[model samples]
Target: MPTVRIPGPPGLPLIGSMVDLARQPLQAMLAAQRDYGDVVRFAFGPPGLRGEIYAVFSPEGAHQVLAGQAANFRKESTLYEEVRSTVGNGLLTAQDADYQRQRRLIQPLFTRRRVDGYAGAVAVEAAALVERWSAVPGGVVEAVAEMSRFALRTVSRILFGADVEAAVDVVRGAFPVLGEYLLARSFSPLHAPRSWPTPANRRALAAQRELYRVCDGIIARRRAAGPGKAEGAGDLLGLLADARTEDGERLDATELRDQVLIFLLAGHETTATSLTFALHLLGRHPEVQRRARAEVGEVLGGRAPGVADVEQLSYLTMVLKESMRLYPAAGIFGRRAVEACEIGGHEIPAGADVMVSPWVTHRHPGHWPEPERFDPERFTPEREAARHRYAWYPFGGGPRACIGQYFSMLESVLALAALLQAFEFEAVDREVPIGQGLTLQAEGPVRVRLTPRSL
Candidate 1:
């Protein structure tokens, strides 16, 4: 085997790059890639500590870790275990066999045909959001909070059917607390044992219980409805309630709770962040916004956007793709080595953390010329076909890639088109407030001035 010889900045002792990383994560990672090449070694924890991490930031490196030798790296254990405090052994927290089984069981609910059906609901929610904005005076609207509310309402409508009001309070209350705690833990090297009665930990535990209560209530209601309910009822909760394993074993209440919790939390938050960032980008680039609005006008012709219109709104799709390329919601993510492996001529021992940052890789100078420019034309079919396969993985790559990708794309395209049709947006701030939490979000309200469109 080759000797382990990755290069990195030997950071300050005891603290070891944590200050730099915490303050400017995306810039720090990008600087490391520029200085040390594709695979850069990073030290965390105290002096002489064993916590050496590797960041992979090239298409080749990403392909190696996320696809080529994928079996050798698994989701980081400590982080996932922490997530399980709320999500339990759901798809995100499940291991090899359990994850495979769960995927099979839930896969039917997200089939292309079914996800397409959710488009009408997505457009309805977006239209309601437009109406709410119309009622308010047209000053700086909080784009981030508004998108979050819209995403939660849309997902709840799709998942819970007619019973959304029953679970909305608990879901809305629990997730912000849960996201703050998870984001802190994921970054901090010095969190106390979660069992300790600390204020943050107490909040986390309380939030977890609230989420469980909400999940339990949703499942109980579905069960009470009886399995004879038609699959055509078309809500996700109904389908999951009736899903059976290959052996014909139905999911128990606990399993049902886990799935619901993970779906509601993970599903809505990522989509909200994506939509928020997309709007921020569009608001800043009025030309792009105008072009997209033109497309929406020509295609929809004063009708609500549907799944069928997703393909026709090509520029709108390109704008969203370009926005995700620049500010990927799950920008910097992690995996852990399950066994010793070589990537880019460096040895990664089992349990060592590995990072694949879309924020870094998407901006890699080698893959994307003029990487910082906001030009959706770069995603044109001809240009995209010329790029590397792993060049722009906003939804990630490989078997463990996000399963909700199709749903998110369709939802974002429809919602974005609908918003553009209803209102024209102008940015309140010259520079956007970029924030990092469970996902990359706008730090403050992405205040935008909205003028009603003359449709």
Candidate 2:
């Protein structure tokens, strides 16, 4: 048997690499890759932890884990367990047969045809957001929070038929707790249960309950309306509520609740982060922003954008594509091997942890020229076609990829086009820090001054 050799950063006797990661996650990870080559391992957990602790980092390694031989890997149980405690058996947490069944039942709803049906709603909400923001006095608006609110409102309106403007307080109340819980789980060992009476954990549990209550009311209202009434209903909640499996089984109340919670949590947060980053990039690069605004102006002519106009807004799409490439909403994805695999001439053991980082891949020197610069032209049809297929996976690749990608893109494009048409943004602080938890967000609120564009 050939002994496998993987290189990594030096670690202290007890703490290993934990402290390094805590200090500067992106920088530390990049340093590790630089020092240790494409495939690197890092230890975690205390000295006497039951299982071995190591992480593998490489683009090829990431492909092997997430796509090449993905059947042999599962979403790490620890991550899923934490999600299960909060959202129950929704698609995000479920595994094996249950996951398979739910995915099948839900897949058709996110298909191109069904997702396209949501374009009008996305446009309407985006136009409303532009109208409201254009009215705000210029100077230091919190773009991060603003975008988060906008995305939550868009998703809420499409899913629950609830007026997001009315439900803002309720959603805002849940964010801090949810964000903290997810952050803790990402760093802490799974064996340490979240119910250990810590203040943060307690707050998370309370927030979960409150969130459940809000979703429960919406689910109940939808259920009462019956199948025929829901047929033409365009919202995600209605589709899930009224949908039946091939075997004629509907998502029961528990399943429905879990799905709703997942959509609410997963649907809006990432999209918001992406849009916030997109706008920030646009503000910094005036020429790119100018081109995008011009595209929106030519495409829509002062009216709200519709599905038909989305395809013509090429510059806006490129801006979004480049923005996401620089800062993917989910910066990294992980999977654990269930069986041994060989990838890029290295052997991966069954129990190893595999990590693919969009943060790293997007900046890979071999694939992207001047990778650190913001260049939307890289996303032009001709340029994009010539690049590696997986070189720019802001939404990921393969069958298990994000189901809401189309909806997300449509929502983002409409919002971006509308906002750019109505206003111009200037960065109040160019050095605002960014962090990663459930999504990539600014360390503090991103303050930007909004100048309404003179008609």
Candidate 3:
């Protein structure tokens, strides 16, 4: 057996590497990679602690851990346990046979044919958003919030038949509470036991219940009304509500609830973040913005975008790809060793945590030239063809890849094309710092001035 080599900062007595990462996650990880080469390992938790864990980060190492010997690694128990407590055994948090079953059952809904059905709704909602924004005075609009609203509306229409304008407040009111609890739990050891009586956790759980209530009501009403009754009833909720497993078993109430919750959360928020970052990048690079606007103009000629129009908007797709490469919505994905394994010739013992950060890999010096420059052309078909398949995985890869990637890409292209056709945007302030959290969101509101495009 080849001897395993672990790279990264030397560990301190009793504390492992937690302090360095907590102080500055991005910089710390970058520095570790610089010092330790592509494959690096670091420990966390108190030194000599019974439950201390180690993690590895390398493009090749990550590939090996996630795809090469995947069975040896599993979704980190921390995330599984946390999500189970909040959302139950849905696809996002479930593992093994249950996850496999749910994935098999739900995969049909995200097929090209099914997701293409949503393009009209996406374009319609985006056009409405652009029309509403036309009235705002020339100054930086909060792109993050605006995109979130856009994505929420898109997801609601497709998932629950709700308009963005109508469902915005309900979803907005609910998500922050849920996000706060999830974020707090991610870093704090006291999280699990504090779900009771504490206001934050209580509010989060309440929000979860309320979300379920709304989805349940929508599902029941759709069922009661029968097929073809509701205007947009064929959305994800309806599909899942009526879908059957391979064995012909239908999703029970709890299973339906979990899938709905996952779609509601995952479908909108991450895409919104991606859109926000894309807009931010576009605003910063006016030339790229002009080219994108020109492409939209030439393609649709002022017509509202539809599913067919999406295929012609290749520049818009490149813009989104480049933006995600710079600021991936989900910055990092994590797993844990379920058994002792060798990755990059290094031993990863059972119970150790592993993280593959797109935030780092997407910007790896070895893979991308002039990594920080805002250049959309890098994603041109010719350019994209030159990169390794695993080199630019914004939505992840392998069996566990995000099932809604095509849906999101289509949604983003239509939304951007619609907005660009209707309005010309410029940054109010170009120096906003980005914060990496559950998603890559602006550290503060991204304000952009919008001027109506000459029709």
Candidate 4:
């Protein structure tokens, strides 16, 4: 069989796609997909190195790399590598045997039934957040920062099973620095290596140290509680602390730290970003917000929302789904081919890095009509059923898909619904610049005018 030459722009020698990717990766990838078809070859670094990358735009190719033939690829991308510096072989960065073992041990912690039990606690926090916002004299809220705090609190409580209010504060301060550091490494060709003593590196290192200390404290306190006390407590930390793999091996201290890092950082970060975007979208679209509020009113009848109300808030679910589709919290997914593979009839060489962007694919014209428009109805049951499984994956696809996806979704919907029911939000700006850090976030604080609804 002839090796198919993947189509893409012929850039200047030495540095190929690096400049364009650094400037605006989402736009660059979108254009590559548009001009070069489903499979576009990108030369990011030296011609002979593994830095030469390929972008997969079509659903068929995404499925091949992410799901159907996932084993042929590994989480060896630059993104995961940068993430590993902080997480250190946690589920997100682990591969093969280590990943399988960790996932098996941690899976029960996030089971549907187990996660449902958290809904009440999450709802309580959501209501408390609304109360806090209402107490604001001016009723103007910084949506991203507010959501970050709320998400941090919720995730900290759920994961730690103890009041780590002080620890949450540490995480809040450190997360943005870490996010900016990771994003810079992912984009800039001139980015300093972790070994360098750059100012950003210093900040990232200090932030990481603080986060590691926080994780260690959580683990030590839980361990001090002992098996009986830990097992009796039903939080994620407890479950993980007490968990043993099929072979009866438990995660060691370092492994515990890594898992906490994943849950604390990635877990809270993505949900916070998604909630911010959801609120921004709702604020921009009034009819959608009104309809959503109506659903909440009809369902809750002026009472605080509960776990059982999740099913009843179908329209709010659609709104959240549409928001993710429009501006996915994690915009791009990357994988490295462990073995040569064929995708979209193009031969992908072994060791090549491959990428799929939710920001691009979700807006593909063939998959979404008026792709730029915000239409919650597009997520109606029928339409979703008809679409490709990989077409709208905000949580990603295949075995390596986000384990906390359900938890994040339930948390986001509850928070969004509760807030919308209590207050009407209006965006201060016609356009908000998006910042692509560890996750997608509004570049600056999302300021919104909040008007408390009459119960």
In the order shown, what is each candidate's alpha-carbon RMSD?
Answer: 1.9, 2.2, 2.5, 1.9
What is candidate 4's local distance difference test score? 0.84
Which residue ranges in model 1 land beyond 4 Å of their true spot?
A: 1-4, 48-50, 230-233
Report the C-alpha lDDT of model 2 over 65-158, residue by residue, as the tens digit: 6677768878774555567777778887677888888998899988887888877677777877877776777445788888888888878887
Task: For model 2, give the 10-residue run with minimal summed lDDT.
Answer: 50-59
Whole-model lDDT per candidate:
0.82, 0.75, 0.75, 0.84
Encode model 1's per-residue lDDT on 361-441: one tens digit a residue: 899999888998989998999999999988999878888788889999999999998889899998876577565666776
> Ten consecutive residues with minimal summed lDDT in candidate 1?
225-234
Candidate 2: RMSD over Cα atoms? 2.2
Candidate 4, 60-141: lDDT as tens digits: 7788888999988889988889899866789888988899899899998889998999886697679889989989988888
Clashing pairs in 2: none
TM-score of 1: 0.95
Clashing residue pairs in candidate 1, if any? none
Best of the candidates, lDDT = 4
